[model samples]
Target: MDHDWMYKASYTSEIYAAGVQSFLSAAEANRVKKRSRSICCPCSVCQTFQYFEDITEIEAHLFENGFMPRYDCWSRHGESLAAFSTSSTANDTTYNDDASSLNSTYNNDSSNLDENDNHLNGPDDNLNEMLHDMETNMGDAEIENLQHLFEDAEKPLYTGSRLNKLDAVLNLSNLKSKNKWSDKSFTKLLVFLHDRMLLEDNELPISTYRAKKLMCPMGLEVERIHACPNNCILYRKRYENEHKCVVCGASRYKQKKDSDEVDDDEGPKQPGNNIDVYLSPLIDDLKTLWDLGVNLYDAYGKEHFQLHATIFCTINDFPAYDNLSGYTTKGKKACPVCENETSATRDVFSTIIFDIMVHLISHIVQEIKACGPVFLRYMYPFERYMSVLEGYVRNRHRPEGGIIEGYTSEEVIEFWQGYVKGLDSVGIPKTRHSGRLDGHARVGFKTFSPSHEDLHDAHFVVLKHMTCLAPYANEHMQMLRLTHPGKDDM
Candidate 1:
């Protein structure tokens, strides 16, 4: 292949265009031969760190940003090592300053190049950075285990297979989650694959337990903190060794395990006014984040920095807001912002009746000044998320478990979708709202044409309500009234 076009001054040149077309054609052929939809994009922006499924996108990126420096080998795009070596030896004069600088950075060590290349070929740049960070903090045994994981990630699922063991396991895990397969069934499927389909030396895990174990290191740890049964407090920090709740004096655990009877006199499950006790852990984390921050590696920048984060604001309903902010949402002096200036009054029954919602309106201006806008700190988004969680509850009896299972399945499915190209989503497709905005059906099964009268009515309603067109409509109406003094105002 002619390589001079890659060094052209203008991407719009005919030679550059032809070269890009040829490169894409070869990449597409290689992709088909490997039974994969995506290829590693070697554009300067991607730097061979990202995979692109669409050839057009790849082409555009290459044209816009040009190829990454010193990427003449094209090993990542299925060019043979022998061919690359032969080309490099024959075209010694083609090697430029960029290649020299890259070589000098690695001290001209072949091992260094191999190590760096291997690191680059890892699952993702961010994932590689995380692994690199982990390697620094981990013990020898943990490092060995991580290395084994890397090997598994790099190893092909089977001989001549395009997919790696890690990808295969992830795909299977996602399938299991989406279909809600039992552990036994998942294990059976794994076994069937191992016994009947895969070769004897295949690296696939034979059980759900093994699969989970394989992927466990990559997952975030979930802390299980014991809380007061009455929702008074969590038994952590100062109360770690305490046997009972500090406020309610309720026992941490039930004395009898065999009894499944419910107490009719038990309080509501919500922490209510004692929500602050449950928020201790979160508060402590925030304090730490504010004061110390955390060390993190920026994969894109290829640098390390400390990341500090703090909660901008809280969003909740009026009653829950009271619990979080330690303000009384009902009765006299209910307004946290107004303080003593509240307008509460006693009713005929000697009851302090005050519209807490109306009182909250006084605080909105101040809140907006501090947090930009009410929408930014409003409960609508949280309410929508709660609705989503509610939908995830399949079993009313075990709603929490159902939500967790559903959420985990969704996460798996989402992660799997990132890897597989052209795979249809598992759930209901999102409605496109084809004709809602444009006033014409661009895409859909059915189409209708509005009658002249209906169109006129719709247009009139739109023109009358639109704030931007209100002035123009009013001006036109004024002109009409002036022109025809006999006409009555509509």
Candidate 2:
């Protein structure tokens, strides 16, 4: 948790002293009237600070230990504090000189205090300074816009029985996947049906825009670039504002149909023929999933934490050491997995974005497996998550946005249903086969309804090939029991 290394080496001691001084000041200002010699320190140095005889001892403890985690102490940020050299101070300078310098810069209303002596500043002055900094950095319009955005984000998506109807329509894959009508008309129709099902209907039916807006949380919105129509090159970076393709000398944007009859008042509009969606957001989310797994483990123990690094490693097909370390194959081998041989071939025309992060996940699998199988992560269990994204069911135009909108809308509806009508309203029934059977016999056991009976055959056939489990037979079990007498059943 000691993050002093993250900042510049010169600023480390300054940040530490500033934090301690601020915390001591705040502690003194907020002290109780009752007689108590000791006060708790909550700085990063001591998250749950030990009792101190007075402010002097507390300040000394903080200077040595450095600040606590930012969450524990407001003084941890010290965004406006100017750096001062306190490295030369003796162990017993009390850090008073450096502390006073920090107080003069960060603490307002210092006119009341003597110049030579160090005095504790109130938390109110620090809060005002922070407020002034925030106002100076952010404009009125920006603050208002942020406030409105957060308000909209907090608003409920749907209410009542309409929520249930929306859920029903969302789960219908046939309707979601196939397009019999325009998205606008389709959304209107779904909303109309939902309205009819509700006891208290909406005065106006849910519009396509609202329905689409509702989906934003579920889907990831990717930043798309207009690429060359002939698949020559992407109009990004150096080519971002270019009007023509560098590779083929073709127009980068789609020309207006009425180009000859141009309006004098308005400028010509340039639209790209082909758009390439950026994958950074999706990659970032995947990386966040790794963070989430670790957090889950820390919060609720291993039973609630599950991440398969192996399958993710295998499917991703990246180097193990490259991600774990900062090693790369630039001007050397193609991959770290392949040794850096002198005669390694290089592809000059390669367009794929190959970086340590693109294959960083493989290292997780390798590292986990090195410890033992119990900690080895697999990617197979996450395959269903791919289908979950596909299930959003939106049009090709801004596909990522549509997917996000559709998924979030469905999630909001499901959440409302669970809240109003109990969790079972949105929960699927668990499927389990009845009766005891040997492993081979269990493979044939049908769990599907009459409508899906044919699917059961196909499912079982696929499962047998996909899985590595050995088949069992009654005769084999009996023979094994006889051969190894009094052996426990597997």
Candidate 3:
């Protein structure tokens, strides 16, 4: 797990992150019916710190619309921009430095900065730094606040116990995070995580987050569940250091909760704050589903690990969507498969890898008329596939509602290439993109004019993966059969 990218976000004003931490702390407080405190955020990345903190009342607008596909879509999504950058493959050759860069925050602690922030009550140095940094670059917090104002915790019309992986990834027609994530940021992060997991192996270290436990259970006996100031170690460390790590002699001492660093005989690090291991519990749960082929918006299904693998394999990768207006679109309601409102979104999260698997499985089962080859020969060891899938999943994937609308043709095209090649290990068609005769699409050209070709490329990656999937499926089965002979039927 090249966790170097773990704390990548600028470590700035992610209100969503703050909110989650607060909510986690609050949950640990006495007198709560549910150990979990649910706060509403659009998705993981786009939420605000306040949102994570349980700053509002709970209410939900039940939506009823959209067709419910049992699982995620094997091939769907309006690829205005997503299709253009289909060059990135899960394969190594097409990896880029920028995608990784996007998730990581840079801490040039070579300079003397703050020390310990022991007193959460005192002015928190870490929080200050993040706030300062964000104010400098993003200007004001108008956008963040406004988005929050309109946000709602309305129960998703799509309710379900669980879903097939493919059926509802982006379904509002379906089922239902945080760095202090915002709705907008949540959408952005989802897209980021999806691409990273699907494309960048460096992002995921755990080949697969094996379903060893139903929950990421932590013992309060070993570690304090909530310690204010301690709860917000970042702030406390900054204050304690009098805003600097005393030992380092460099203002930036390695401490909990601080992003800035002081110069030292040693090189720079993120102050090694206690927050390193600390994560929003709910957010982590959200991530769990994401790894299992769910998206941020598919928050309706809260079931942990124990799910039907057979159903999971079929519904993982539904379709990608694009409604720039970013509102609920009316379609169908009261799905037959799950008795939930068929939302534009579903309860199940999804990923490109699972989608690919479903596509290939469907073909081998129905089209090729033989699931044996895929199960035996092409499927990489389930562990390796999952290892790679995790990395792909970790990369900043599609945030809640999905990617924002303001990309240029070139950017979209570039992203499309990166996504497909980096994610599926299959290259998109060059001809569809209007090559400059060398069979390569030229940079900065207007080659992207939405064609049916885009759709085929999106769906074809799954088809192509089928070519290799046969072997992996066989191996996956072989391994599973040995371990859980009774359950290998999936």
Candidate 4:
């Protein structure tokens, strides 16, 4: 919670500028000033000597790209400084006294700290001092204060202690895909590990409920609802207060307990047979994403197209002409545009001309005639997204809630991993020569093109090697011919 040492140990702009300015010889410095030209900066940041007007400009540029005295301190304390300011700024003033006082003691008691392997001078010595100050500044800071720093642009920032443990717990959830662990088993393992961590640290392990309350970053909770065992009806909507199924007349709950566990007989005496989860929170979050413009991907990457905002028409095999009056599919009175319609049910289908499909198809034909086939719309891509959602229901007690958890957990992992977003895991072939291309070489050896009338067995031998016509090949061909005696090719 307190990061006073971060500021103290960090190199000032002047120090880094001085370090770079002093790196040059007096003669070189004098030449640089006389020429009034840019020189290569010797600092770690801009080593290429990017253009600067004079020595003063070069010095200012070098100072802007300041050198860090301790890489470990900059890496560790940068996040702590940002976190200390943002997360708990109000109560931070109280910890300043303790931090300052402990820092003073550390300045005096340097030798005493050496007994614990904490040297006052090393690569990590600055970090050690800062950590000590943070500890003394807020006695419970190590356990209670969680770092919530803004993400770094170039590289991911990692924090120590409780944040790392929480990250590990989160990462363990991702092992579900490969190991296929049951929800109860996974949660039990996590809680067991959490308890072990507490015990090993000489801290009193708290209950699972308390640990979750303290450690869960998102603080998401499951919503539980009681429902019928048969899933015939949810105990919601008009049946919200119902005690029994309206259609089945089944009892909504089991018999009451006989002991003091039964608090009263005022309500239903038993628990419902099923627990249904309502994931309105997840739905609300998806909606929030939509409102925030994050759902722009839903437009199927055609957002730049002018027609994207409009739903022109739905594409389907709708027999629109068959619905016309006096049209009989087999009597030549069928649809002029469709050549495959038959006599069956043409008149019956005509009665449904007022249906939504016919109206949409009419508009689609008009759009196609005016523009081209590109204007047509279909539900195929949207159905693919439905399949993705369906695949998320594994290893869960509740399929509906399980999907939400799996999807959100994957998103979190992907965020931390900094993966290129948006469903990049589809149709990755085993090899470049896999799929239809694998048989291309064999297909090139075919002696002749196969006909629809040719039997599968005859085509198989032709596909293997078309050029050879030896005794063995002839005998194999003869055997195939004898197996299919009635074939036209035979």
| TM-score of every model versus the real structure | 0.56, 0.30, 0.15, 0.33
Candidate 2, poorest ten consecutive residues by summed lDDT: 79-88
How do the candidates rank by TM-score, highest first? 1, 4, 2, 3
Q: In terms of lDDT, which candidate is strongest?
A: 1
Residue 485, model 1: Cα distance from true site in angstroms:
5.6
Tens digits of lDDT, candidate 2, 239-271: 789999888888987667755775564432222
Error of 3 at 202 (Å): 46
Candidate 1 deviant stretches above 4 angstroms? 1-142, 182-185, 257-268, 326-384, 387-465, 479-487
- Model 1 gets an lDDT of 0.65
Which ranking of candidates, highest lDDT first?
A: 1, 2, 4, 3
| Model 1 agreement with the true structure over 1-490: per-residue lDDT tens digits | 3366577547887667666666675665655444444567878877665776556688889899998755564545656434544455463332222423432432323322222122224344244334334444443335445655555555677765556787688778767765667778999999999889998778889998788767645453456688888787888878889999899999998677577997676543666787787788888999989999988756446556898998875667878756776667776677666667665433322334336675676578888888787766788778877887777676676577667766765665564454444433545354677567766755555768999999999999987888999788889999999999999997
Candidate 2 overall Cα lDDT vs. reference?
A: 0.43
**Model 4: per-residue Cα lDDT over 1-490, one tens digit each:** 3323323323463433233333332313332222222233333454332433234554555456543222211222223433444454442322212333433432343233223231111222122233322323332233224232111111111221222333333345445433546566766765676565544542222343333333333434455555654555666667879998776777799767678674454432222222112333344555665455332221222122211233245443333233323234334334344435333335445754433344345356666767677423455565666776667786444567767765665554444332221222222224655545555565446557767667787777776676565767778888888998877553
The local distance difference test score of each candidate is 0.65, 0.43, 0.28, 0.41
Better of 3 and 4 by lDDT: 4
Please provide, for model 3 over 405-431, each residue's C-alpha lDDT reduced to its tens digit, 9 standing for 90 to 100: 111211322322332212211212235
Prediction RMSDs, each to the true structure: 12.2, 19.0, 31.0, 17.1
